[model samples]
Target chain A: MKFTRRDFTAGLAVGITAPYVIGSARAQGATIKLGMCAPVTGPAAESGGYAVKGARIALEAVNKAGGILGKQAELIVEDDQTTNPGIVLAFSKLAAESDIVAFLGSIRSTQVHAMAPDVLKLGKPVMIGGTDPNLTHMGNQWLFRFRPNDSYSGRVIADYGFNTLGKKKWAVLHSTDAFGTAGGKALGAALEKLGSPAILDQGYANQSQDFTPVVLAIKQSGADILGSYFTYENDIGIFARQLRQLGVNIPWVGSPSITNITALKLAGPALYGTFGVADYAEESSEASKAFGKAYRDVVKVAPDNQSSWPYDAINVLAAAINKAGSTEPAKIREAILATRKFPGAEGEYNFDQNGDGLHGYNIVKNEKGTIVFDKHIEFTD
Target chain B: MNNPQFLLPNAVMDLVLQLLFTGIGIGAVYALVALGFVLIFRATNVVNFAQGEFSMVAAYLMVVFAVDLGWPYWLSFLLSLAGMALLGAIFNLGVYYPLRHRSFLPVIIATIGASILLANSVLAIYGPQPQVLEGWFETPGIQLGPVYLDSQYLLIIAVTIVMVAFNYWFFEHTMLGKKLQATSQDKEMASLLGISVSTMIMITFIYSAVLGGLAGILVAPVLFVSIQMGSTIALKAFAATIIGGFGDVAGAIIGGLALGIIETFGAAYISVPYKDGFAFLVLVLFLVFRPQGIFGERVAEKA
Candidate 1:
């Protein structure tokens, strides 16, 4: 027990290495930790609820299939409050825990953008549902998308409206938030490429109580086709109601939100006959069908992208961690990127170099309160 | 607001007509909520930041009664207003009464605290999903000539007009209103003159809550019942109060109408993204040029 020069050096070494060795022991004592930033309160709380349920369902399945690294997987969730600042705070709260190796990020692109810097600083792989193309493309290797980005949605919407619907003059309306702004620009660019430039390119702030001016503008523009990127279902509900009320019933094709269960319920009859580029469709594939059944059995409701992405995210993250046989961030990232032709609820998971898992959308219609799948549009380019 | 900008000469008139109707509809909504702010500000020198939350709470109450409990629309409306009236009383007792003798800063801070408490309480109870409350009318809207009038908007406008008329008659002619006015003018003097100042203040809170709740129920079908909905309406209504001259009943209505029209026309001609900016810009301009507000100078600075 006597202290000597060699003993002092040995004690210093033990002090330095103890936390790592003890931390590993502690990590091994419990299940594999996965942090999740979810919207437990605020505007997106309902969708956030669905997302949590999806992750939990996937967690159940993963545990049933023998979880990651021969240990049961654990999911730790923090309320993001569905705000940019909220997600940052939530992610930080999760990041504070040194044991959590990976994270499931927000479905909102803006929320993802807000948390991107922190994700990079954390240097842990985060499975995201944010579809902003720049999310993965922004040189942030830690972030991997579970859903198809807006680029595919924009192209699908434009292609369907032009080639299938046979509409030319278009009025594009979008929310002014990061997601909507990016989606609107993508849609605009896509339409331009299809030789059908938008007659009226309008961007309204989200949660708008009134859409009279927007409806009036669309009416006067004489646009036969409408392409929209609404952020919130409330806005969609209001806009659709006002659009119909104002008698501007142009053939409307919108982003994924248009055909979501939340939007469909809120907008009701007003949203009937509109088209949306959905990332998850029940009939799109067998994986999608299976996800639909699993979700419906657990959630007692039809599955949408909100629930589907998180479900796929948890499955993918767990699968990658298992494939790598480790919780090391770089190994998990490598495993995730190498994943190809993996059947997912969204679609086939073929991760490109940029960490995008899916690169296509299924066209869905609100046919008398039912989201009927139209066709799938996949892009290799 | 009905300015001719990008429309053809023929279409300009129609657009103006439509904008005017829509503006008035939206203006009436602001006016209704602004009246609550005015009533509370008139009675208590401190502005109740919870004034907006009053509408939100009422809307949620409506959802609970009407949608959740499946009560009749009229019964649910009455029950929701009743709930708001009770909340007003509780808010006064819990938040305002204790701080009654304190400085205006303490009281204002208390109201802000109360606002957060109210919003969080609702969030705890109802959750965050925005609920839909169908309008009083089965028919959604009516197309009157060139203008498509939303039924809810029309109902709001009519209610606002009736409220203005009723307020004029009640405040000018009724003995109770005169006594309440006296209490607002000078609580000490009114108390000396045999008016129960505390009772008058309580009535004012009740009326203000009822007014705000009414606005919420009316606009719920149009805006959809959400936590943030009231704050959005209340912001413009607050601007309306300032523009119309703070604490003046008439000024709040006129200011609300003006703000609504300016916003609509501004979004149309000027820029859509800056729609809210136009309202605050007008507020800033008023703060600069006419700081006393449109009606602030009148009534010899009473009370």
Candidate 2:
């Protein structure tokens, strides 16, 4: 058809607008999308919120310094609802998006376990804070950890309980789930290496309101020290309260749950003098201090391991994406594995081939319900 | 393959008894919650999934009235109970009444939705963190020979007994009780007789909600008040109700106590890891073998 002056004007406008819209969409395509699966509503919500906050802070910092591959990064968050089934569904929804270059896993080993098969299927790198050592060795190529596994923490706890405290007899308490059982076994093996096995080894379930019987058993076992791997903050709080009420005043060394603010706040003075190997402590390092201050400014609360690790994971992932020069999964994986001497809020991390990093733990003490950073313990294995 | 030694030494026995007492103290709290579940289910066909959250909201309200608003413990407790009763009535009017004629699934889902909204609203206002209830009547343990029982345990048991007796009298002796029974049995007949079935249901909801609120206030010192605390206890109370016999008041009490003892003894003697599973195991077994529950009457086939 012949074009009039008005038709020609409209055609020019359409041509110009179409190219801008197409260019904008293509430009947006350069930005990498990352999915974060965290427990935002259940018992672990406190920690999960922190993790999200940490990730956001890291992402903002990365974007300010010129985002990954010169494009802005976006985080797509899904609440895991603090269950294995919920986590699996969340991961599947994230994986279906196709644009996500990497994934940020939850702090709970069970959540990671539920999401791992999907991660392997998707072939995208996942930075996780779950401490279960077997998560990495489970032959999942895309699974990478940002914190020292429970095996390392177990060794640290065992050594500190046995050698540092000079307590030979031990009572080991853990949850019956996979993470607890694995951590308990690792701790038992570590203690055995020192020629001092746990006198009374016990496993309990989560969300228990009373832990008196378990504490009494430990008290009766004649163990002068207590080693535990509690999977939930509430259970740990109850256990700590009952342990004190039963007059079992032995030195207690535990996993990261002992340092969680929820446990500390719930247990109150009951958790005083308790020790744990934590991934993050506000006083751990300069990076942690700065992060803690920033977090406190935003959330009006101190940062915990759950918050710090995800924060660091995002930073490390962003750094890798920038270095990779593309949002492609394989390239991002390469950049992540190449992470070396990266200072993060959690600690200096180096992602190994198996996707584990931060091969160290911070020895912390709960002083009158506040986590006091004591010292750092590094492991080579 | 021999039986493992279960008894502890004398010193350990003393410690174990103390721990058992502690469990019982908390068990009393569970019993109170389970009792609310039983009362409502017995009076109405509704399986109020919001019972635990009702308790939580009441407990938090007590904190607000007592601690923040600076009311005395007793006054705060009474005011919170009244507030809970009002909430119960409102919930019935707003939620259950609209969906009363619907299938059980919709009502159940509606309760779940209400629970989510209630919990999140609390979280949004109070923030998602645990808050300690101040001015608790945490009396020191009373020593009776070798066993030391906390005064809180005694208070819980005494309060539960009084509440149970009051509920029994209200359902058995009063005119309102007869109307409630009539409404529970056949709503059409009750309404035909001008007993006001809708009004009776509202009263039942209020009574149950008040009981749940009382339970929450009493147990707050033991379990602490957190937005997410309701779901766990609610599940346990559901299991307790099922095992005791759904819609049976006495069965609920028996079931709650039995669960408490079983869980306590199992944790002490058997496996602590499987302690919480004890209730579920019993619930499943009962569901398979005795679907009508321990105290429930067998129903005839519908015409």
Candidate 3:
């Protein structure tokens, strides 16, 4: 009827502001929302599934025990595709959902590094399983590690090989990615500190079809022991088989990936008798055994660090949220940092200023396919 | 690759022999997959980016038949190849046939889309866990003097050689091969000559799919059967095709072998982390210097 400018301006303003107002209201809904970025499609899809399951199981238990802040907790997951860009994209997607109180990040250090900047920008507590020591020390307050960093793992591997196994000459083999490079360097440094430097420090690319060159380099080095940091289970499988086939059998101790279920299944007999510094050895503690049992009943498979770290991360995040009594980022951060002696599937959570939960690693061995717990090595410093 | 700088004389000899054997073995895989790319490019004048997924899909088919269903290995192998041939036909009908009238860019994009679809489809069906496929040989490997010969690698090399011979006889000496070649050269001329150009194109797709499948099946034991496996090999295979001369048969084989050897030796000598870099570096150099490839005919000469 009467087309007035004032009426049109009022209608335009209402339409423009409606979405933000409605979206903000929806963001403050009933359930507590936590976001997670896991490898739902790419090379790490299998482990990513396990991570999701672990987090789900923890959320289930938390909800059963009366939920977080007296409200039912919920988890929102995004497919990281197991790539650096994938995680960054996944993290951004989760961060955009303003209601999410916290996040569970990638187990991969490369992915964690990729998403670290976003995590810092978002200013929310991010539970991570990436073992790269620099992740916590990189001045990112929002990133909290559920697993022990590689520094502890390197030292443990070195200590076990040198003191326990009495192997002097070592060939340090690692992937060239951020995780592997940092791990290799840490192990090399640890070996040097032990006064038995690595005979050959070799770095290979991930997803390598063949490890002949690296294996041959190890063979030629005349090392009595081999310590490795492989990023993928398939690479480990190929390398382990090639190592034995090339007739260069020696005492081998490796990172957590060596003891992974995927690696065990793939490498089979090739990985037999090798030791790995695991962050979640079932026999390490009652909490670990309980989580392992629960995971087996649900997932119908033996639990590895892939599942354990996420399990611990979810549990700790839930507990921290409850302790803080609010969903505020700074309060949650403080609560997470204050968390001490909190029994988790990975280990007792004693988060230092660096946001690293467990300060030690459990050394486990592969006995003919089954991963058997050997010993636990904890560090005071 | 050259005079030993770090290794002693005897050690150098052993190292060279080992790396050479491994190089040829892995190179044979690249050659097989590259052969598929060459065939499709020659036939359709469009790169089938999904060639790698053909191998991956075949591998998963083998896992389903051989591992899951517990069928005989030989039977599974044949059945997997059959399935791949069927997939190839469907891919041709669905992806290429409709887009045949379109420009090369759309067809190329369609192939890439098909690759993503194929990968995700496998992931959806089989789940994400990488499956272990046992090698045809019971013995893992044999130590031959200084070199360790992997039985799977040996099989891959032997199969590659036989395929090279088969491809030669099929394309050069056979009537059907002549028709296929004729169609690839000029569909209109081939159709005018009473040859069904569409049929020739279909056969090329089937054959290329089978070749890609063979490569996947053979290498499954070495590299575990996974969704990403196809894409990884495809990238290197694509590089091989470019270096070998995109449409040349002999070039695919030699180029694959050359790329494998160069990367292996380069990793050993230069830097292991830059192993993939070495492969693409050679590819870049080839593109810069000999754009037509090792066996490709010069553009001016062809004109």
Candidate 4:
């Protein structure tokens, strides 16, 4: 109780650092938190499950190998409901947490677009799987794309169909949404470059119950080849069946949805012998194969872009955080932007200044319900 | 080569025929779901916003019994309908009966709330993944000359035909059906006549639920069963009901077919992106010109 010199100094020191000590203690309560907006119960819910699993698996490995900044990494997920508004709301809920260092956004381009304004407001680096070319190019510095944008997919689809299939006249079909429209334009541009401008370019709304008009037009167009960019698995499934039914069976190559598990299951034999420019072909790369084996061992399903991109996103994000040696957003963003020659389940991550990680796609063939990886097509530019 | 200027060429004829068949096929699905809407509106004097959820719930039930439990398809079909009947009863007691005396707005809002609850409950239980239901036919479709017929669509068309015939017979010939119609037309009058108005309303709910369930089951194979399936189809069905005449059964069928055909032809000739636009455009035209609907009796506005 006596006010001595040593006691006075000790009391003053304790008073100065008390709040800091309490803050540090509270922070140590759990691992580094990363938020994810996934379709927990909407049209894309099935893929949402895969996305969650992929991020967890990758994060688990990261945690085992020495957690992010020596703290175990934890994932926080909110249901996006496979809708634009749903994703925006879910992301806002997660963003309000304030403790989450970084986030993973939707795979659907439209959903990503929906949450982009809020993401910019939060000023945090968000890894997204949406392949719309405009996603990264729309001057949203905070939005980093884990998957190659649809431009690569469009080019790959057009290249494979025109060169490999040896077909000249083309019928291009696409969904009218952002992803499909960009993809169709890219495909059309590529085909024009290859001297095979599509004789027919048609756009249909998503979730169309029927595709007879589209199919009949394709048949009437007299195109020897078909190229497509579909937004949903079920839409593509319905279209595929109707196409075969209407006898419009020409050499066909489509974007990634054509090779996804849902499309394969729904379309069945109708999709046989078709080509798709998949970003995550299981046999495309050693990393892809490894991820495929790991995913199947755990999820008991074939690996596709839905799961693979998030898997890569976690791996890259964790590594970037490690390299930056901090949980600060600016440091992590720099490390991510500087990521080079980082092998991922999708492909090699060579992020550009604009935040694109991959620059090409893998072409796969659906042969009798089996997806056989054909070849990888990467562009230097 | 010498076909009339107005008449279609052979190639054009084939396209028209295919589109027409597809239009009719999709129209039948809309008609089937629209029937539930019309029936419920007739009984309750309030739109059952959850009519679509009824279809979704029944389809999920079918999936549980038929696919998950691996029961025989026919047995699953029957059990699913039975489940829907029970749900209809619960819905009447919980949703409609409680608000029987309330204005139509609150009841409509309550039905909307029920729809959200039903969809979320299923999502919580089933975890949001779309399920695939195999069609009744092993053969996907049959190619007859230039036109191909999907077996599922064919079955839907056949079922719609049977349902229309059955509805005509039931409403015209059966005492129960007449009692139900009387109750819908005038609940107090029917009760005064000792028709048991509440019982007729209960029966109407059950019948509409069953009808919605039937449409869901029939379309599941084509659309692939998902949580949003009910709402998507219901939107078009709502439009069909409007076009058909709000209270008229036959009007729903004609409206559905007409919408389907118009949309198909519009997409084929005009713009595929505006496919849904065509359906609603026709709806707008009808609303502007014929708000009472095609088959609905001329209703004088209350002065």
The lDDT for every candidate, in the order shown, is: 0.90, 0.81, 0.93, 0.89
TM-score for candidate 1, residues paired by index: 0.94
How high is the lDDT of residue B125 in model 2? Answer: 82
What does candidate 2's lDDT look like per residue over B155-261, in tens digits? 77778788779878988999998888888777888889998877888888898888888888887766778786777777887887777777777777777777777
Index of the highest-DockQ prediction: 3
Best by TM-score: 3
Interface RMSD of each: 3.2, 3.4, 2.9, 4.8
lDDT tens per residue, model 3, B1-303: 222457678888888999999999999999999999999988988999999999999999999999999999999999999999999999999999999999889999999999999999998989999999999999888889998999999999999999999999999999999999999898898899999988999999999999999999999999999998999999999999889988889999999999999999998777888899999999999989998899987633432
- Residue by residue across A104-174, what tens digits does model 1's lDDT show? 99999999999999999999999998878899998999999999899988999999999999999999999
- Where does candidate 3 stray beyond 4 Å? A1-28, B1-4, B298-303
Q: Count the backbone clashes (under 3 Å) in each candidate.
A: 0, 3, 0, 1
RMSD of each: 7.2, 5.8, 5.9, 7.2
DockQ, prediction 1:
0.37
**Candidate 4: residue B186 lDDT (0-100):** 83
lDDT of 2 by residue, A89-176 (tens): 9989988977777899878888888888888888888888888899999899788788899888988898887777899998889888
Error of 1 at B10 (Å): 2.0
lDDT of the structure predicted as candidate 4:
0.89
> Candidate 2: which pairs clash?
A54-A311, A144-A355, A145-A355
Error of 4 at A298 (Å): 1.8
Across residues B1-303, which tens digit of lDDT does each residue of candidate 1 receive?
Answer: 222466788787888788888888989999999999998888888788888899999999899999999999999999999999999998888888889998778988998999888888888888877889999999998988888888899999999999999999989999999988898778899999999988998999999999999999999999888888888998999999989988889999999999999998888777777788999999999989887789886423542
Candidate 1's displacement at residue A206, Å, is 1.1
Indicate whether candidate 3 or candidate 4 has the larger lDDT. Answer: 3
State the weakest 10-residue window (summed lDDT) of model 3 chain A: A22-31
TM of each candidate vs. truth = 0.94, 0.90, 0.95, 0.93
Off-target runs (Cα >4 Å) in candidate 2 are A1-27, B1-23, B67-70, B101-109, B138-148, B186-194, B288-290, B299-303
